[model samples]
Target: MKITKQNIRTALWVTLSVLLVTLLLQNSANVNLRFLHLRAQMPLFAVIMLSALFGAGILWFARRRR
Candidate 1:
C-alpha cells in the first residue's frame, strides 16, 4: 500500500474527531495524581482538543516538504 498526503490527513481528522467525542462524553471524570502533595483536576475535553490541535499542526509541518 502506498501512503499519501490525503491518507494521512484523513486519518488525522478521524482520530481527532474520535478523541473529541470521547472527551465530550467523559468531561465530568476527574483524574488524580499524587506527587509532592500536589493535586489537579482538569477538564478532559480541553486537553483532548488541545492535543488534537497540536497533533494536526505537527503533522502539517512535517508533511510540508512532500
Candidate 2:
C-alpha cells in the first residue's frame, strides 16, 4: 500500500473531527474518570484543539525529517 498526500490529509481531518466530537460529548456530559485521589476536568473545545494541535505538530515533525 502506498501512502499519498491525499491519504495523509484525509486521515488527519478524520482524526481531528473524531477527537473534536468526542471531546465535545465528554465535556457536555461532565464525563469524569478518577484514579486513586487524582481528578481532572477539561473543557471540550480546549481538549479537542489541544489534541489536534499536538497531532499536527507531531505529524509536521515527522514529515520534516523525510
Candidate 3:
C-alpha cells in the first residue's frame, strides 16, 4: 500500500492504543480514593478514566453555557 498522511495517522493511533492498553494492563492494582465523605477502591485505570470523563463533562457544560 502507498504511504499517505491518513494511513500514517491511523498507524499512529493504533500504536498509541496498543501502548495505552499495555500500560493499563501493567497497572492492574487497586488504589484507595476518597472524596469528601465518600471512599472507595478501584483499579488505577478506572480511576483515570473516571477522572477524564468528569473533566470532559465539566468542560462540555462550561462551553455550552457560554
Instruction: Score residue 56 of candidate 1 by CA lDDT.
Output: 85
Candidate 1 Cα outliers beyond 4 Å, as residue runs: 1-19, 30-41
Q: Tens digit of lDDT per residue, candidate 2, span 5-65?
A: 9999999989978877776666653335456998777565665667678988999999999
lDDT of 2 at 4: 98
Model 1, range 1-66, lDDT digits (tens) per residue?
Answer: 689999999999799788778777878655554458777666666666666789889999999968
Q: Scored by CA lDDT, what does every candidate get?
A: 0.76, 0.75, 0.86
Give candidate 3 regions above 4 Å deviation.
Answer: 51-66
Compare candidates 2 and 3 on TM-score and give the better one. Answer: 3
Cα lDDT tens digits, model 3, 1-66, are 999999999999799778767877787799999999999999998887677579879999999999
> Using alpha carbons, what is the TM-score of model 3?
0.63
The candidates, ranked best first by TM-score, are: 3, 1, 2
In order, how many clashes per candidate?
A: 0, 0, 0
Best by lDDT: 3
Which has the higher lDDT value, candidate number 2 or candidate number 3? 3
Best prediction by TM-score:
3
Candidate 2, residue 55: the lDDT equals 89
